[model samples]
Target: MSRRLRLLFTALALAALLWLLFAAAERALALAQRFLALPEWLQWTLGSVLLVFAAAGLSVLWWLLRPRRRRRPLPVPDRSSLEQRIGQLRERGADTGALAAELGELDRRRVSARVYVALFGEISTGKSSLIRALAPHAQVASDARGGTTREVGHYDGAFPDGRTLVLADVPGSREAGGEAHETLACEEALRAHAVIYLCAGDLNRSQADELRWLADFGKPLLLVLNKADQWTAVERDKLLARLTQQSRGIASAVLAISAGGSERYQRQLADGSTESVERQRKPAIEPLLQALDRLTAPGAEGLENRRENAVLAGLHQRTGTLEARTRAEEAERIVRKYARRAIVGALAAVAPGSDLVIQGVLATGLTRALAELYGVKVSDVQIEDFVQQAKLTLRTGSSIVLAVAGNALKAFPGLGTLGGGVLHAFAYALIFDSMGRALAASLAERQSLDQDDASARLKELLADAGGTRLRQLAALTIDAVRDRVD
Candidate 1:
C-alpha cells in the first residue's frame, strides 16, 4: 500500500480502538456504580446477572441492526442475442429501426462518460424551473411561459455522494413539430441515460400517444405532473387519477410537483447578471432527485433491466403492427398466386388422388413464400420437408375430420372424386390462409423454431381456424379463384 493510505488506515484503526475502549469504560462504570449500591454478596450476584443480560442484549442488537441482503435483480436478456434479433429486424426494415440504433448508441455511451438525464414534457410544464433548481449553474429561463425554451439546454449537477451527471432540458413538445426542430427532441431523448417527462392538465388522446412513444423508447423514465403548486389537493388527485388511467402500460412512476412555486430560484437581472432568490419552491424537487439518484446510480439492476425491456417491448409492439399490415397487403396476393397453381395441378390429375396432389403443391408453395417473407432462407428440400410436416399434421388432426364431414361427396360414393371441386378448392384456400396467419404471427413475435416443434405448430395452425372463420376466409378466396378462372 502507498504511504498515505497506510497511514490513513493506521489512524482509523487507532481511533476505532480508542472509541471502543471509551464506550466499554462508560458502560462498565455505570454497571459498577449500580452494583456497588447493593449489599456486597448481592452486588456480586447481580453483577454476574447484569453481565449475562448485557451480552444477550448486545447479540440481539447486532442481529437486528445488521445490513440486510438486497434482492438480486431480474436477469437481463442476452445482449448479443438481443442485438442479433434487432439486426435481423433492421434487415427487414422493422418499425423499431430507430430504437434499435439508439439503444446501440446508448450502450456505447454508457462506457464513455457520465449518465445524461434529460427533462422533457410539453410546454409550460416546468422543465426549465426543474433544471434551474437542480443545477443552479445551468441558466434556464423560468418565467412560466409556454414554449419559452426553443432548444436543448445542458446543465451539470452532482449527487450527494459526489457522483456527477449531466442534466438536460429539452425544448418542449410545442416546438417539437416545427421543421427546424423536428428531430431535436427525439435526438435528445435518444442520447439520455434516463428521462423525466413533465406534464400538466388532463392528457388528451394525442398526448397519451406521445407518452407511449416516450415509454416505447425503453429508457429509464419518470413521468412528472408539473405545476402541482397551482392545483388544489382534490384537483391534483383527480388529475393524477385521470393521467394514471390514461398512461396505463407506460411508466408507472407518475408524480406531481411544482419546481417554481415551492422553492427559491435564480433569475437573470436586467443587466444580465443572475440573482439568487427564494420562491414557493414546492415542486417536490427532493423526491424527484432521490428517484433520479436511484435510477442513475451505477450498476443499478432496475435501471438497466427497465431500459432494455422497454426497447424489447417497443420492438414487439411495432413489429406486430407492421407485420399485420404487411401480411394483410401481401399474403392475399401470394395466396391467390398459389391457389391458381393448386387448381392447375389438380385439374391435370386422375380421380381419387387429384385433390391430394393439389394440397401438396399448394402447401409447399405457400410454406416457401411465407418462410421467405419471415426472413427465412429455405432451399427446395426444406420447403418440401415443411410441407410433409404439415401433411402429417393434417392426417392426424381435425382438418380431415372436418373435410369428410363437410364434404357433400360423401353422400354420393360413386362420384367421390368427380364433382367436389369447389369444396376441395375452398378447403385448400382455408388451409393456406390459416398457415399463413400463424407464420406471420410467429415471425412478428420473433419465435425461434425447432424442427421438433414443427408438427405441433402445424397442428395448431390448422386447428386454430375453426369453422366460422374458415368459412369466411374460404368464401373470399374461392371468389378470387373463380374470378381468375372466368
Candidate 2:
C-alpha cells in the first residue's frame, strides 16, 4: 500500500474511536440533566437504585475474573498418634522402616540449624543448570537427556546477604519408567525448608498438580521459569504474567531465569576451518536470587515447624497407604481360610442339600475376625446379627449360588469325576467366599458394619460366577474332599 492509503486507514480508525467517545459523553450529559430535572426524592431513589445495580455488577465481574488462590493448610497428624500408628504397623509385620526414618530425619535436620532449599521440576527443566548457577564452585552435571540427575546431591550455596544454605539437586520428575526417582524427588522436597519449582515453559496438567501437591504441605515455595534467555523480552513478560497468574496463592512468587545451560556452536579457526565449540550461556538469575533472599529470610530455625509438619504429613499418607494394603492382604487370607473350612464342613455333611446352609460357627468366626482386623469393635450380639443377615442373603441367592457351582463342576471336568457331593462342597466354598469378601469390602469402606451395604454386596457376589473364580473354588473343593478322604 502507498503512504496515502495507510494514512487514510489510520485516520478512519481514529475517527471511529473519537466518535464512540463523543457519543458516550453526550449520553452521560443527557442522563445527568434528566436526573437534575427530577424531583429531589425521585432523584435520590433512582440514584440509590443505580448505585446498587452498579455495585452488584462490579462484584459479579470481580468474582468471575479474580485470580484463583488454591493454597490449603497442611493437616499434620499428632506426633504421638502417628508414632503409635507406625509402631502398630511394625507389630503387624508391615514395613515401617521408611516411615520411622522420616521422623528421625525430621529431628536431625532441626538439630543441624541450616536452611535447605530443593530444586524441583520435571526432567530437562534446567534444575542441574540452575544448581551450577547458584553454586558455581560445585561439580554439578548437566545433560541434554532427561533423568540425568538420578539421586539427590547437596551443595553449599549463599544468598546475596551472605547467609549460607544447603541446596539439594534432586532427580527430575516425569521421566519414562521413573516412578521411584520421582518419589525420591518428592520426599526430598518435603524435607527441605523451602522449595524452588523450576520449569522451562508453561505448566502442564501434571506440573500443575505437582505444584498444588507441594502447596498442600505449607512449605515456602517459589515457582521459577528457567532458560528465560531463550524467549524475547515481550514473550518472556507474557509468559511470566501467565505463570504468575497460574501460581497465584500456591507459590510465594513466580519469576524467570536463564540457568546458563551449555550451548554448542560452530566457530571458525584462524586456518579458515570450522570447529564445534561448547560453552555455557551466561545466566540471568538476578530475579531468582532476590526471591530466594526474601523467601529464606526466616532461616532454618524459624522454618523448622513447617518443615516438620510437611515431613510428618507426607509420612502419614505413606503409612496410611501401607496400612490399607497390609490389611487388605490379611483380609484376603482370612476369607480364603474360612472358605476352605466351609468346603470341608459341607463335604462331611451326612445329608448334603441342594441349597447352601452356612455353618453358623464358621460364619460367626469370620465376622468377628474381619471386624477385629479392621479395628472395629463389635459385641457378640452384633456378631450374631451380622451372621443372621448373611444367612438371609444366602437364602435369597442360594439357587443362583448352586447353579454357578453346577456350572463350575461342568467347567472343571476333574471335579465332576471326584463325586456326587463335590457340587455341595463347591457351593459351600462360593457362599463363604462371597460372604467374606462382601463383609470385608463393607468394613473397609464404611469403617463399621452396615448390614444393608454388606447384604447388598453379598447378593451381588453370590450371583457373580466368573470363570476364574469358579476354577479357584473348584480346586479348593477338590483339595478339601481329597484331604478329608486321606
Candidate 3:
C-alpha cells in the first residue's frame, strides 16, 4: 500500500476509537442522571459510574492532544540524478525531427553557391518592393506600418553564374520597442552572409534607429537608400553624401535606389520608352553591387571565414533554445523537491513528546503555511491525505493534536484570536520566504548552464564550427554574389 493510504487508515481507526469512548461517556452520564431521584444509595452508585466515565473521557482527550514523534529528514536528490533528468529532457527535445530538418535546410542553403542577399530596415522601407523587382515570383507582404514581417522570409533564385542566391526579407524595425526584435532580425541577416539595409527616401528618426541598431551586428552592410525618385537631384545627392560620409569610418557600403523607379525602368525596356526618362529615374544600385564584388574576392581568406561564422551562429541560436527549455524543466523539478522537503521538515518538527504544545503549534502553523503557499485550503482531511500519501507514521499522534488545536482556534475566541494571527504570519514566512528562495536559486543555476566561452565550443558542437575558416568563406561568397549582381 502507498504510504499515504496507510497513514489515512491509521488516522481513521484512531478517530473511530475516540468517537466510541465519547459515546460511552455520554451514555453513563445519562444513566447517572436518571438514578439521581430514585434513592440515595442508587444515586451514589450512579455518581461513581459518572466519575469513572468522566476520567476515561479526560484520558481519551489527553491521548488525542499528545504530540507526535519527530520524523527523520528526507535525503536530498543527488547532482547526478538531476543531471540525468536534464539529459532526458534534452534527448526528448532532440528527438523532434522537425527541428533537425529546419537546421538541415539552413545548412543546405548556406553551402548553395549563390549570392544570399538579405533585405532589412525600419518598417515601410520598400524591402519587399526590392525583392519583388529582382525576382517577380517572390511574394512578400508590403505594408506601410512598421514590423509587417514577423518571421524571416526566404527567396531563392539563380545568379548569372548558375549559383543560386537565397534572398531573405526580415521584419521591419521600429524606433522604440524594437531592439530585441531587430537584434534577432540582424542576427538572421548576419547568417545570410550579405545585408541590404534598405531605407525609404524620407529617412526619419525611427529609420535612423533601425540603421544604428544594425551597425552592432558587424556584418558587411550594403546601404540601399531606396525611393530616390521622391527627392530632387540636389536633395538626393545631399542625402547620399551625408549617408556616405556617416559610413566612411564604418566598413558599410551605401547606394541610393528607387524600387518604384526600377519597375518603371523595366516597363521602359519592354516598350522601348524614352531613353532620357529611364536614365533620369535609374538609382545607383549598380555601384553598390561593384563594392560587394570587391569586398568578397575569390581565393581570399575572408570569404571562407564568413561561411564558418554563419554555421556557428545557427548552432548558437539552437543551443539557446535548448538552454531555455532546460531552465523551465529545472523550475518544475525545484517545485517538486521543495514540496517534499517542506512536508518532511514539518513532520520532524512535531516529533518530541514533552513539548506537545509547541509541537502542535508548529505543525499547525507549517501545514497552514504550505496550503496557503500552494493555494490550497487547510483541513484535517487534507493533512491526513498528505501524510498518507507521504507514507509517514505519527508516533506521538502530533498530527491529531495539531489538527485539534487548529480546529480549537476556529471555535474558541481567545485561542482563535491568538493562534490564528501568529500561525498565519509564521506560515507565510516559512513557505513563501524560505521555500521560494530555494526554488528560485535552483532555477537560476539551471539557466546559467551554458557552454563556457571556449572558441572550440561552437566548432565541437556545430556541423561546420571552424570560426576563422567560416569567416573567410562568407567574405568570399559575398564577393562572388556581388560580382554577378553588378
Best by TM-score: 2
Which parts of model 2 have CA positions greater than 4 angstroms off?
1-59, 67-70, 141-144, 265-276, 351-358, 379-386, 409-413
For model 3, residues 99-207, the per-residue Cα lDDT tens digits are: 3444565567546645566787877677776676655587776444542676688886443344455678887777366577676676567566667878766456765
Question: Of the pair 1 and 2, which is ahead by TM-score?
Answer: 2
List ranges where model 1 is wrong by over 4 Å: 1-75, 89-100, 120-124, 128-164, 168-191, 197-225, 232-256, 260-337, 346-353, 364-431, 438-486
Q: Which candidate is the best by lDDT?
A: 2
lDDT on C-alpha atoms for all candidate structures = 0.65, 0.89, 0.52
Q: How many clashing pairs per prediction, in order?
A: 12, 0, 30
Report the error of model 2 at residue 289, Å: 1.7
Per-candidate TM equals 0.43, 0.85, 0.47
Q: Model 1, 154-238: lDDT tens per residue?
A: 7887777788878878776755355344356657765677888888788866567667677656566777787786799999999
Output the worst ten-in-a-row residue range by lDDT, candidate 2: 349-358
Compared with the true structure, what per-residue lDDT tens digits does model 2 show for residues 88-161? Answer: 99998888988988889888899999999999999988888888889999998544465379889999998877
Error of 2 at 30 (Å): 12
